[model samples]
Target: MSERTYHHGDLRRAVLTAALDVIRTDGPSALSLRDLARRAGVSHAAPAHHFKDRSGLLTAIATEGYDLLAATLADAPDLRERGVHYVRFAVGHPAHFQVMFQPDLYRPDDPELLAAKARATEELRAGVADRTPAEDAGLMGIAAWSIAHGFATLLLSHNLDRPVGDRDAEEVFRALTGVTFRTQPAGSRVGDDTMQE
Candidate 1:
């Protein structure tokens, strides 16, 4: 592979990092390969060489986000912890979180993206494992993911009317999850807390 190819390690990471910064500051719709290239101090064509196009870039971001999500959820002690982890992941990595769920912005057919998403799904499911009966395990997993995703999205969008003064979203999420954990049958709900661990 040429130095310009993605396997170059540092360059690709630099570009991705720059892309994340762009997304965080101006939102995903504002992201452009040209802007990312400039931010990374690479040639205008560099990002294209790695990501192919804007969709490819977003796909790569989503893929990375999924892997991170899986890792974040892997060690949660319980369903409540999982929910806290999920919320924290979203708030901590808002830029990647913003693009990961937007199918219209990324290539869903990408192999890496598919694999990453599968891993994330598996991690989420593991949280509810053995807690619910096998027959309803799938439904429990879905419920857990739905609640965590909904809460995280609402928090990120500022749709949650709660005052967050001097406190991060993760703090609010942990409290909310601690109480909300009972809403499910002791087997559902995932949360992400950046402030904790």
Candidate 2:
């Protein structure tokens, strides 16, 4: 094997990027810091500087994923749009999505991971700021998160085999949301804006 060298000043970022690439193509089971170092053209021990071990590296990936998801969700116009954005991000960044939510595999409490997760949560909250009341914000957040997360998980697992047409998954998601929430318009008199409330 050719020994490639990464002279890039940002070794940590390089290692993380390489790790993400591996996760994308091979799934989380195949990830390793040594392997990432190799892919990044750095010495086997180089990754250790940034990520003390495999778990650390995975945590970094999860943290980055949260940040990315937060950015995507923040751009949506409303809560429903945020849900669509959530699904899109999950589908587009399967590797990151896989690592982000698997608390068993990564250290969710890591400072970076926690911060990123908080940012994403805040973004989701912002999306529903106008429509959902302060008292119902938490419930609204959970409901929206559940819908988007459930749908994305289903799609990722191939549980939903419906052949979506030329329309993007976001379009299909909106349609699904419409069908699911048709009765409740933006100003509907709902109980705490929650399904169980």
Candidate 3:
């Protein structure tokens, strides 16, 4: 293979992007730094320079996942929306979601990962704070997370009974939560913003 070079910090981003694509297509177990370098068109040693080993690469992915999740949740207007956003994030970033939860795959004790996880946890907890007492917020947050996470996992694995392409995830989530969707005009579709409950 022809050797390639990256300018400045582009190498790290390229490797991470390639890693995500590999993980998304074949799961994290399929990830190889050498293969990642080839996918990124970089020197064989390039990925190792940014991520020392497999675990280090996984740790970086997990850290990035938590931070993204936190930001996604923070953008929502309320707990319900946050829960919906969580599922959306999981589905959209399946590789990240898969890696973030499987603690054995990465160095969970890494400080940056810990901090990012804390931020995500805080965002989740904050979503439930207004609805529950301080002592119960944690439990409620977990409940909300469980619902969203389970739904996303089932959806991702094609375990859900419905036709995924025909339905809006947000609509299904709202229906599961006992909230009915408001009617839309003729020719309206699942994701046209009119399907929101």
Candidate 4:
């Protein structure tokens, strides 16, 4: 069968989507602009019209990832659920997750990237707004991010396969979040009431 043709307006998205697939299967180090163009069935320079270079394409992918994460967080009911979804997204979309946080590899300052990052941060903060105190908001946000990010990192690095029930990542995340909140210091910004048993 012949390769499908992407219309002009959608070629950029198609290229990015194909690039993500490449990264997911082959790792970041294996990504190449020419390869992505080939996979997308477009001219080698087609991606340049939308993304000036490899960094530009990577930045666009990261921006798209952030936007997706922000939407997932927004759909969650509470901070805990939001955190769970965040971790889930990371594990489920390893390629996007890998690129989104690597500032050195992508141009974080790119307009699309900056906006998406800001929106995602806002979404997380909004999820915690009602449940956490003003002073604790920042800490709570960072803590939630850390919990998910750390868990994802651990799982990705294969360090989470210990005898603790050979716990699945989601279970480990929930357990860690529970334990951390329960053992928080008295003066800790996050109150015990916010934690689920």
For each candidate, give its TM-score against the true structure: 0.82, 0.83, 0.85, 0.81
For candidate 2, the 10 contiguous residues with the lowest summed lDDT are 188-197
Q: Is candidate 3 or candidate 4 better by TM-score?
A: 3
The runs of at least 3 residues in candidate 1 whose Cα sits more than 4 Å from the true structure, single-residue gaps closed, are: 1-9, 161-168, 181-197
Residue 114 miss distance in model 3 (angstroms): 0.5
| Candidate 2 Cα lDDT to native | 0.83
Q: What lDDT does each candidate get?
A: 0.83, 0.83, 0.85, 0.80
On TM-score, the leading prediction is 3
Better of 3 and 4 by lDDT: 3
lDDT of 2 by residue, 1-197 (tens): 22344455788989888877888788888988878877887888888877898898898889889999998987898878999999999999888998888898888778888999999989988976789888998888788889999989888876665555355778878988887787876775633432231
Clashes of each: 14, 0, 0, 0
| Deviation in Å, model 2, residue 183 alpha carbon | 2.2
Give me the candidate number with maximum lDDT. Answer: 3
TM-score of 3: 0.85
Please give, for residues 30-54, the per-residue lDDT of candidate 3 as tens digits: 9999999888877788888889999
Tens-digit lDDT track for model 1 on 1-197?
A: 33544554577788889989988888988998888887777778888877899998899999999999999999788877898899889988999999999989999999999999999988888878859899999999888888789888887787664455467667776786666655666555454442333
